[model samples]
Target: MAQDPRALLAKADKQASSARGGFSLFGGKQDKLEIAADLYTQAANAFRVQKLGREAGQTLEKAAAIQQEINEPDDAANSFVEAYKAYRKDDPSSAARVLEKAIQHYTLRGNFRRAATHQQNLAELLELEIGDIPKAVAAYEIAGDWFQSDNAEALANKVFLKVADLAALEGMYPKAIERYEGVARSSAGNNLMKWSMKDYFLKAGICHLASRDKIAFKKALDSYVELDPSFPSMREFQLLNDMLEADDGGDAEAFADKIFLYDQMSKLDKWKTTMLLRVKSSTTAPKPPLLGCIEEDDDDGLA
Candidate 1:
């Protein structure tokens, strides 16, 4: 008479065992397996309602495994996602593990868009849950590539921007610049995103300056102008030019002045602010003034 999870799971286990025993007049083995899978799903939801997350997750995993054996990748992946949701609150690593299985299922189905989205989700879990920045960046990059290949440039750019942010934070300037440039070039062709191109180019320029490769930076600036002639007139481009001049002169004050003025017009985000600070630090000026000890009336000859 009990409707508890254990009782429901026991019923589902009986159904699954019957599925593998022999074909019956009611249904074939495959049909019985599907019924068992459906029962497992019901048990999983019951476990979830009871706040037994690990039990729910495991039950859903069993459903997913059965679905996978029946060549129902979509159902398998959906079950995996449900299991991941169930596990995330209690055991995030297990959530990530099951989510990876879902991604694999989606990839095997040639559903790259879904795969890319799950990849981004995995990246978020790695970043926010596990605190794995490098893996997060790598996951984001993979998502970006998948999105791009799927002709989902908008999604690709969004993911690539995350890649650039974390990559730059890790001092992977070249990778950041590449990602920013990729987004910038892609955005240039879209009217709605065109306005943000300057922002992307500015980020790429900042990464270049942070790398201290003046020749490459100069070349990139020229290339940007060629890529989008309007880029030369953009305030973001002008700010980068001024910052580059300040870097060349080794004048920290000049760099700070330019940044302050730009911030007045358009505030910089934390990432940009951090990168600019690194570029400003390349300057040799603004050395800390030595604390001078003033002899207060030492002329009294007290020694």
Candidate 2:
């Protein structure tokens, strides 16, 4: 006599459950794709026992598709996730596949933010990985932008400093300076951050000078002095003195006077003394020299 279909179905279901249970606890370390395939196969077998041909067919199809992904996956991490989710309730394999898909998708993006997230997940998967610092720096910078947009200046500044440190490590002083400036500028508008400005301005000035940005150097120096009178940097001191004396806009007569004063001081103290006395004895206030007159004087001297 033929067995009752319901009893046969119950027996098949029990066997399927046993297979799935063994598969789930068997290995803590297995390929995500392989485990997912096994679970799907078990689910299909159970559905077939109940004569649910449609569900069985669907489960088998999902298994094959997921297996193919492990072989030659593309940019469809999202799709993989969806498939994994749909079958995960009955399968631990599916859950693992979902997490793997998340990593794959993020890694494919190549953007600092995305790569950072993926790299973090990947790091958890392995003990030792190379080039982590560079990735961390890039991620921190990207996170800085996100934090800035969300009005988290303190966090942003922290990340900005990390970027500067990385740039310095790469021997990219100019790039490092730019990153430092971002930190300074973000702090500038707030009174609480005012104390930081003194150091920030001085550092910016030094970087500007090194980069040959005379205009930026001058401006930064001006800010630095305003914040603190005793700012050190013999280079800035000399530059400031020359700039003040050159207020006549590079006039040859003014330059000659500078040279003359130096020469007199070097020759004899009495000569400088006499020159100072004469300068103080002028009967009338001197008029400002016209810029055009300096050019004409230059032309006449050349001719």
Candidate 3:
């Protein structure tokens, strides 16, 4: 007798169908995918036990494909995740592929938070593993909203810094300064804020200098000095100082001539003298730089 081979196949198919149905009981809408996944998982195990690895992988892949086609993205994502975990040690590319699938699944579901998390993971891979700066930047930006919402300001600031650095590398001074400003605004009163302000002032000063906006450059440089007196770039400070001293006969000359000569002028005296002189020289100047420094609201005008 032929031992009913047809009957055995029929029974296996029935069991697989029933397993698929069971998935719906656990969760609606995505039941089919879950059920299929479970059935495929069992089939994969049986194939493995039978020493048919290729067949096991194929069966699992079919389950994942079905879930994807049916729009059961979460289940499909989980399936790929499982497959990658099973085989990634032997093939690193498998992990990347699986993660991409998960990202797409989350994106399609409007799960931005999850998508952003995956994007950040992708950025790590692109930056450290693939050495792809543009790709990493794209991923980092994709996760920007998430970082902002999560109060991960430091990470957000770091991303902005990276953008600024990249912009500076590309010689886009305005864009770089914009990025630096973002970093400063995000830093607020934290230690990171102070450092970011220092960097921003320096970069902005350079941008102003490049544009030959002497007044703005001087202002930025002064802000930099105020923020970080011991800034690592002392040479830059000295260079700007020399430039100011070199002014032949204009306000710079007169200012330079009397610079910090006041009896009570401390090391901080230069900025004060410059401010007073600037105000005296231009009464209509909208507001003094000292306006920004004063945290208090008062009607006292430079007294």
Candidate 4:
């Protein structure tokens, strides 16, 4: 005769309750913890056999938690990953939560590579599944920091770029600029990254212009010149300088036409094209008046 599924569940529950009682009596002794983990695993197996997926995942998570308390972090992480897999089919949010637990366990165990990998996974889940761009950015930044701490500069740079891109998409221009500048500064010291530094400087300058900070834009240009004195001879540098001068002269239309002509003659890359458009838009707007209200009224009553 086949055993009843409910009977198996009841037996598993009894074992779990007994294990809990042992834990209370023994105060997390190794034997008690081992017993609790075993009971939880058994309960999870019984739940799975009965097609109670949610219950099975929960029970497996409980087993994982017990492993954590017992200082078996590797076991805890593995069990949490298993629980995440179990929950993924029916409840993606729950699966993400379990994966977070797994990441925490991996981080606590000083397995930074695994932790960073899982953090990236969680970020992707938040972005794709939850549609939380801010939280996803934060997760990616944390992952990047961890990768940097592990001396994985390539991986760290890739993750940081994601953060910068998302920040820009979210309209946080200052943050995007800062991240771009940081990556640019880091890349400047590397011969392999020589070609990318100019692009980074260009991006940072473009962001400064987008933020409507002419002072910052000028400073960024100066910094670029410092980095590469030959920049002034470059067509990009000459174009931007001419645009600034045109804006100052209140002839933004002339600059826009000039850019259009230049673009027709030589197609610009996406970054340069977008940046020039931003510059044109900036110049179209009139500058704000420099002087505010006077403290004292004159004889003409001007204040």
Candidate 4 lDDT tens digits, 3-66: 4535644655565566566435544556666776776777777766667767778878878877
Weakest lDDT window of 10 consecutive positions for candidate 4:
290-299
Question: All models: lDDT?
Answer: 0.86, 0.49, 0.55, 0.72
Which pairs clash in model 2? Answer: none
Query: Candidate 3: worst 10 consecutive residues by lDDT?
Result: 262-271
Q: List, residue by residue over 40-124, the lDDT tens digit for candidate 1.
A: 9999989988898989999999999899888888999999999988998787899899999999988888999999999999999
Which should have the higher TM-score, number 2 or number 3?
Answer: 3
TM-score of the candidate numbered 3?
0.47
Which candidate ranks first by TM-score, i.e. highest?
A: 1
| Residue runs of model 4 more than 4 Å from their true location after superposition | 1-59, 69-71, 82-92, 229-303
Q: What clash count goes with each model?
A: 0, 0, 0, 0
Clashes of 1: 0
How does candidate 4 score on lDDT? 0.72
* Distance from true location, Cα of 55 in model 1, Å: 2.4
In candidate 3, how many Å is residue 95 off? 5.0
